[model samples]
Target: MAFRKFSFLSLVAGGVAQTGLAPKKFNSLPLGAIRPAGWLSDQLNVQMNGLAGHQHEIHLDVSQVNNTDWTGGSGYYSNLEEAGSYWFNAAVPAGILSNNAVFNNLTLNFLNYVIDHQDSTGWLGPEVGTTKPRYLWGRYPFFFGAIQLVEHDPTLADRVVPALHKFVQVANTMLHNNGEGVDDWAATRWEDFVMALQWLYDFHPNGNEALLIDTMKMLKATGDPWEQVFATANFPTKAVDNTPNPFPVLTWHGVNMAEGLKALPSTFRFTHNQSDLARASEGWDNLFKFHGRPSGIFAADEYLAGLEAHRGTELCLVVETMFSGSFLYQVAGDPKYADRVRSFSSVAHSQPLTPRHMWTRQYLQQQNQIAAKNMTPNPFPNDGPYSNVFGLEPNYRWPKFITNSFVVTPDNKSLVQVYLGPFSTSTTLAGNNAVTVTVDTQYPFSDTVKTTVKAAQAFTYLVRIPSWVVGGTIAVNGAKATAVAPSNGLHAVNIAAGTTSLVLNLPAPITTESRPHGAIAIHRGPLNYAFDIPRTQKILARNAAEPRAVDLEFDSSGTWQFAIDPSTLKFVPRTVSALPSPVFDQAKPPFSMTVTACPISWSVAGDTFAAVPPTSPRCTGANTTLTLWPYGATKLRISEFPVMHA
Candidate 1:
C-alpha cells in the first residue's frame, strides 16, 4: 500500500481527459526576456564574486580523478552532476545576463563538455560502472539546463535535442530492466523531469518528444505516487530521529515536499484533472497547519520540524519553495499562489540570501587554501547544489525570480505582474508592434509603484494589487482615477499610444500576528519586522581534518531575550541615495523602526534561541527604546516575541 505505482496513461484513461486543453500553452517566459532594473540589477551583478560565478573554479577540483564522487574515483559515480546541472541552468544564464566574461566562459565550457562527450552507446554523464546502477536524479537538471541553453543560443539546440533523445532512450531501458523499484532521490523528484519533457514536447512536437514524454512518464509512473502522498498526508509532521539511517522514506522530507508542491499541479497541466489542483492546495494547507512559520516557510532542518519559530528552515528549501510556488501560480493562473510568492520573496528567501553572500566570501578564501593543500572530494559541503556552498547560487535563489513570476498572458496580448521587484519587460503586441514597460519603486520598503509604459499602440496593462494592500489606489498620468478599485487584486488600466504613467499606491500599516505560544510577529506589508539583537560570529571548522572546511556560528552580543511593547511600535524610513552593495545587507538597512521593549529571561537549546518565547517573562530591565530591523536585514533576530506590560 505504501509503494504502489500508477501510470500517467492510467490516470488519464481512468477518468482524466486531455480534451479542452490547448494544443500549445506556454506558461513561462524565456530565460532573459525580463531584464532587471534598479536595485535588482545591482544584486545580480554583486553575485559574480561568489559561488554563482566561479563554478568553473571548483568544478574541476570537485570532480577530478581522486574525488570520490566523480569518474576514476573509488565510487565511480557522478555526484557533481547535480551541481553541474544547476551551474548550466542558473549560474551560467545569470552570468550571461550580467555580462560577466569569466562566468560566460565557464558556462560555455560546461555546455561544451556535454556536446563533446556523447559515448558510442549514447551515454552522456559520468561513466557508468558495471556493479553500481546510475542514478536518474541528475538527468532532470541537465535536461532542463539544455533547454535553457538552447533558448540562449539556438545553435546549441542541434547538440542538446539529440543528447536528450539519447538520454531518454537509455533511461527508459534502465526503468524497464529494474522491475519498478525506483531510486529514493529519483522517485519523489521525477516530476521535474516530466516538466522538462513537457517543455521539450511543446517546442519539438515533430521530433521524438511525443514518445520521449510517454517514456519519461512511464519511468516516473513506476515510482512513488506523490499525488497519494500528499492527498492522504502519509508522512510524519514532527521532527524525529531517522539519522543513523536516512528517513526510511522520502515523503516526510521538507525540501522534497517543498520542491514537490508543483508535481500534481504540473501533472494537471497535461491531464487537466481538477483533483490534482485540489490536492496541491490541500498539501499546502497540511504543510502550514503542521509546520508553517511566520517566515513564510515550513520548518525543516532536514525534515518537517513543526511550527516552532526558532526551528530553522534550509536555505535550499526556501529557494525551491519559491520556484515551486512560481511554477504553480503560472500553471494554475491563480493570484493566491502569486501571493505565496510575495511572502517567500519578501521574507523567507530574502533573509538567507544576505547571510549566504557573507559566507561565500569566506568560502572562496578557504577554497583557495584547500586547493593548495590538494584535498580530495573538496570537503566543502557548501559547493555546487548544496545550499551551504556559500556561493551566489544559494545567495540568489532564482536568477529568473522576477521573469518567471511575470509572464505574458495566454493570448500574448498583456503582461501579468506577480512580483514587486523593479524590472522591465519588452514584448510584441497583437499587430507586430513592440511594447516595453518599466516599473520603478522601492517596494516592501515603500508602497508606491510607478510604471512607465511606452507602446506602439494602446493596450490593457493588468497590475496585481497584492493581497496585503487593502486600501490600494491607482492614478493615471498623475491624476487620481477611480476606475481602478482596491478590492479586486487585479487592476487593469489602459494606456495611450505614447508614453503614460500608471501610479499605484498600496499603503501598508503596522499589524501584529499571533505565534504558536502567546508570541507575536509584526508586519507592515510583505516585510516582517524583527527585534535586531546584537550578535558576534565565530568561525568553526566543519571537519577537523580539513581546516579550510568551515561554517559560521552566531552568539548573542548583548541580549536577545526581550519582548516588544506592542503599543510603542513606530515606523521610520531612511532615505538611501543608492542601494546597498548587497540589497539585503544588515549593516546598511534601508529602513528602521523604534520600539519600547524590556528584557526577559529566555533559554537557548543548542544554536537556536528558544522557539516558543517565555510565556510570562518578567520585565526586569528598564524599558529602553530599541531599534527593530526588517526580517531580511538582521542575522540574529527575535521576530516573534512575548508581549510586555505597559
Candidate 2:
C-alpha cells in the first residue's frame, strides 16, 4: 500500500491561503499507518471478541446497516444520529486498526451501497426530496466513516470523493437558503461537519474548494457561538439550569460540550484568527475547572453536573473528550492536550464503566460508586433509572476510535506525541526514506519504555516528556545521552540509519490530587489508584427480545467508606514473567499498592449513592492495610477518599 505524500503547505492550508496563522505544529499519519501491539493489541482483540464484534447480532435494530434507512431501506426505528451511520463510524476505525476482515468488509459494503444509492439531487441518506424534513447532523458521522474508509483504501476515492462533493454543494445551498437543514443538534455540532469538509479540501478537493469554503462560512454564521461562549462571561461557571424550556439549550449537553472543545481551534484553520485559537484553550480549562473529576473527565451525566463525588459522567462524553484532546494536540502542538489524552485513555479506560469482557457498559460512571443498580429517583437529571446499569443499550453505543501514532512535524521529522502502550508505525520520512519505529513497553504499568527504530537513512526523533515527569532520562545505544531540558514538553534525539535502540526511564513517583471536600486521589504514572472493594455480580434476567444481550448489577459486599493515609503508600509489583493477556482484569492486576486506611463515618446520599466525602472526617476504626489497584480494575471503588491523619 502506497501512502500519498503532500507538501507541508498543502497539509496546513487546505489548498487556500490563511490570513493570520502558520502551518500546524504536527500532522497525523494516514489511517492504518500505526498498528497496536503488545498489551494494547490484547485490549483491542478483547473488544473485537466482545460487544464490538457482535453488536449487530445483539442489537439488530440499530447495528444492522443493510436494513437501516441510511442504506435506503424502510427501517428507521432509531434516530438518524444513532442508526447505521453511528455503527459505521465506530466499526471502521476498529476494523482498520485491528485488520479485521469482517469489520472491513462490513464498512466497505455500507460505503459502496450509500455511494451507489445516492439521490440524483445530491442529497445523501434518507432525508431526501425537498418536502422531507432534512437534518444535516447525521450526515456528519456518516461522512466521517466514509473518510476513514477512503483513507485506508484509496481506490474508493474516485467514487467517494465525487459523492461527497455533490452533497457539499447541496449543503451549501441549504445553509444559504433560510438554513434549510440546520437544527439545534446540527447547529451546535457544525465543528464535526467542518472537520469533514477540511479533510476533503486538504486531500481530495477535486475542484470543489470554493463550495466547501462557502459552506463552512455559512455554517459558522448560523452555528452555535462557541467562540464567544468560551471567550466571554456567558460560559457556565456551575451546573447548567435544566428546567423544562421550549427552546433547545445545547450548552449543557455532555456530548455537545465534548465536541465543542475543538470548535474554536478547528475554526481557526479557516479564520486564522489567533483569538479563536486562544479561546479554545480557555474553554478546555473552564470545563474541567468547574466539573472535572479525579478520573480525568468532567461531570456530565446527561448535562454538565457540578464537581460532586457521586455525580456521574457519560461514557460517550469520555470518548468524545478523548477525541477532542487528541485533535487539539495535533493541531496546537500543546503538551497539555497530549497529557489530557493520556490521562483519559489510561485512567478512564480503567474505570468500571464497562465489564471485563466488554460485553455491556454503563451510560454513566460515578466517581464514588458503591453499587451498580437502578435508582428510583434517578440521580442523573436527564437520564433514566437504568442509566448506571450495565446493559447492551444502556443509553447509547459509543465506539472508541482513538489511536496512537508518530506525528509528522512541520520540518517532516517524526514526533512521538504520546507514550501509550506498545504500538508500532511505518512511514516515510524526509527524502522518501522509509522508517519503522516500534515501541515496546508495559507503559503506565511500568516506568521503562524501549523504542527500536529501523530507518533507511538518518532522521530526527522527538519524544514528549510528560508534564508530570521531573527526573526523566533517555539512553541512546546503552549510553546516557547529554540531558537537554524539554522545550514545550518535548525532548529531541538525533537518530542514525539502520537499527537504533532508545530507552527512556521516567520516574514513577506517587502523587496526590486534592478533590472536592478535602478528599484526595492517588496517582502513579498515568494510572489512578483506587480501593478495590469486594463485590458480587447478579446477572439480571435476559431481555427476551435481545436474548444474546445480558444486563448485570453489582452490589458491594465489603466496606467502601475508608479514609487513606497517603504517606503510607507503597508500590507493590506482582512477580510475573509477562503481563497478563487481559491486563485490566480486576482479579489479575499487574501491580498493586498497600496503603494505610481506616473506616470512616461516610454516609449514603438518599440511600441511592455514596455521599460526598466528609471534610476531615473522623476515623471510626483502627488503621488497616488496604490494597489499591488500577482504577479500571475495580468493579466498586473509592477513587477519591478522605484523608486520615495519624
Candidate 3:
C-alpha cells in the first residue's frame, strides 16, 4: 500500500498477530442518537467495506509538495498510515464489531511489517534518526489498536506495546532534539503526540502520564493563531493536481488535529484548560460565521470562491466536519449537532461515487449547485446533476475519516432521531442487566410503525415518541397500550415485553410556514422550501429589506399580498426547462426579483406581518398568489409566489 495513493484492499498480503486488549469505553455526546442505529450502521458498513481489504495496507506518503512535480519531502506518507490505523482502532471494535475481520486481516499484515523493525528506542513509525519534524502525524492508531485488542487477545498486546514504547521515545526526543523549543510545523508537533499518547495511556501500557502532560504543555507555550478553526486556509490551492481549477481550501488536517486535541484529554483525565477551550470556541464560531452554509457544513470549495466564480471545496472537509460535530455536541449537548449530522447524512453523505458505490469523486461536493469552476462553458451551467472527480481513487469503502464512524449517547437510549424505513436497534432495558429490547420501525414514507421487544428478564423500556407523532396509540399483542408525550418533545412508554410487539401511528405530514412577501411555503420538518420552477419559465430572486417599510402581507384568504418596492425585486431574463426526454436542462443563472413581501398579516395571530411565501404563482408576474412548499418537496409548481395588496 503506497502511502499517497488510497486503495480499498490492504497493501499487506501477509497476516497480523493475534492480541486481546482492554476495550476503551466510548462516550460520544448524544449527537448520533438523532439517527436510526440501522441507517448509521448501514453507512458505516459501506465505508468499512470500502476499506476492508486495507488493514495491512497503508498510505504512508509525507512530502507536502502538491504542485505538478509531486516531489520534495512529499509531506508525510506516514501521516496517512497512522490515520488508517486509527480508523481501524476506533471504528472496528465499535457497535458493529461484526466487521472486525476487515482490520483483523490488515493488522495481521501490519504486525508482520513492524514487529522485527523496532530499535532499542522502540519507535516503529518513519523518521530521520532522532530529528523529527513538527506537524500532525496520526500515530495513535497503534496505541488505540493495541488497547481495543488487548483483553480479547493478549498476544496482540505483547507484540504492539513495544512499538508504542518506541513511539514515545522518538516523540520525546523530537521536541528536544532540534534544541529549539515548540515553535513551528516540523514533521510532528506536541499536540499531535499528546493525542496519540493520551490514547496510548488509556489503552496501551498505561503510558507515561507525567511525560504526556509535559509534551502537551509545549503547544500551549508555542502559541496559537486564529484559534477558532482547525484548518489553515490555502485559498486558491491547486486541487490534488488532477482537477483544472485551483480551489480555495480549508484543509481538514488543522481542524482534525484540534479535534484530536479535543479527543486526548478525556483519555488523560486532564480538565480542559480555558485557553484551549477558547481556541476551539472561537475557531468554530469563525469557521461557521465565514464558511458555514445553511446546511451546517463549512465551505471547503477548493479555490475558496473569491469574487470570481471559480473555487472548490474538498471531499475531506465533509468527513472531517462529522468528527467536529460529534465533539461539539459532546460539549454543548445541543440538538443542533444532531440537526447538522442529519443534514450532512441526508445530503452530502448519500451521493455515491459513480452513481454506484463502485467509484468515488476525490473532492466530494460543491457549494454552487452547478460546479462552474472547471466548466465546459459552450453552454452555461445551472442546477443540474452535479459532478465530482469520480473514479476508483484510494478509498471507495471504509473512508479514512469522516462519514465513517457511528455515534451513541453515553447511556444507551434511543433518541427519536431519524424517522426511517424499517430500522432496528437493541440495548439493555434501563437499569436491568438481563433485559434487552430492540425497537423496529417503518416510517416517514409510511404512517404506521411496528416495534418489537425481546428480553430474557423483565425490565422497563423508555422509547422517545417524536412530537411529530400525532394521535398515536400503543398496543401489546392485540390490545391497546398507554403512551405519553411528557414535556414538549419526548414520548415516554413503559414496557416489560419479554418478547412482545408494538404498533404506533406516525401521522406526521408536511406543515405550512410563511415566507417573504406574504408568500406561503409548505414544510414537512426542518427543511425550508423553493418552488420547482419549470425550465420553460423564468422567475426572479428578491433579497432586500427596507426598515419600517412593510410591503407584503398575508390574509385569512390564504394569499400573500405585497406592494412593489422597485428596489427589492429585479429580473434576469433567462428561461429554463424541467425534466426532458433526453435530459434535464440545467438551471440558469438566477434572475433579479421585482416584488417584496414585507407587509402585515391578519391571521388569528393578529396584525403582525409574517414572512410567508405565496402558494400560487405564474407568468402574470404582477399580481399572483404565488404558491410555495417547504424546500424538501417540489415535483411541480412555483415556490416563490407573489401577491398584490389592494
- In Å, residue 242's CA in model 2 sits off its true spot by 5.5
Query: What digit string (tens of lDDT, one per residue) describes model 3 on residues 1-646?
Result: 0111212121111222212221222333111122233333444554444422332233233112112232222223244344544444544343224345645544444444444545565555444243664333445455544544553456766666666766666656654444233333322223444445555564554546656544444332332322322333422222222334221122233334324334322212333333434445444545554444433354443322211112233445555456555545444333344345434432334223221232233343332222211223211122121224332224422221221122233454332222223344433423553433344532332345576666655544444344444565667666865554533233444555457676766454444333334544333333333333332211111112212111111112233333222223323222333211111112211221223443432221113222333333322344332233222222122333333343
- In the range 511-593, model 2's lDDT, one tens digit per residue, is 89988899999887767788887888888857665564678888888899998888999998765657786777775667789
Q: After superposition, how far is residue 359 of candidate 1 from its true place, in Å?
A: 4.3
Which 10 consecutive positions of candidate 3 have the poorest summed lDDT? Answer: 546-555
In order of appearance, the predictions have TM-scores of 0.86, 0.92, 0.55
lDDT by residue (563-640, candidate 1, tens digit) is 778899998887776667676767556777788888887765433335357776789888888887777666557778
Model 1 earns a TM-score of: 0.86
Residue pairs with clashing backbones, model 1: 51-391, 51-392, 382-388, 382-389, 383-389
For candidate 1, the clash count comes to 5
User: TM-score rank, highest first?
Assistant: 2, 1, 3
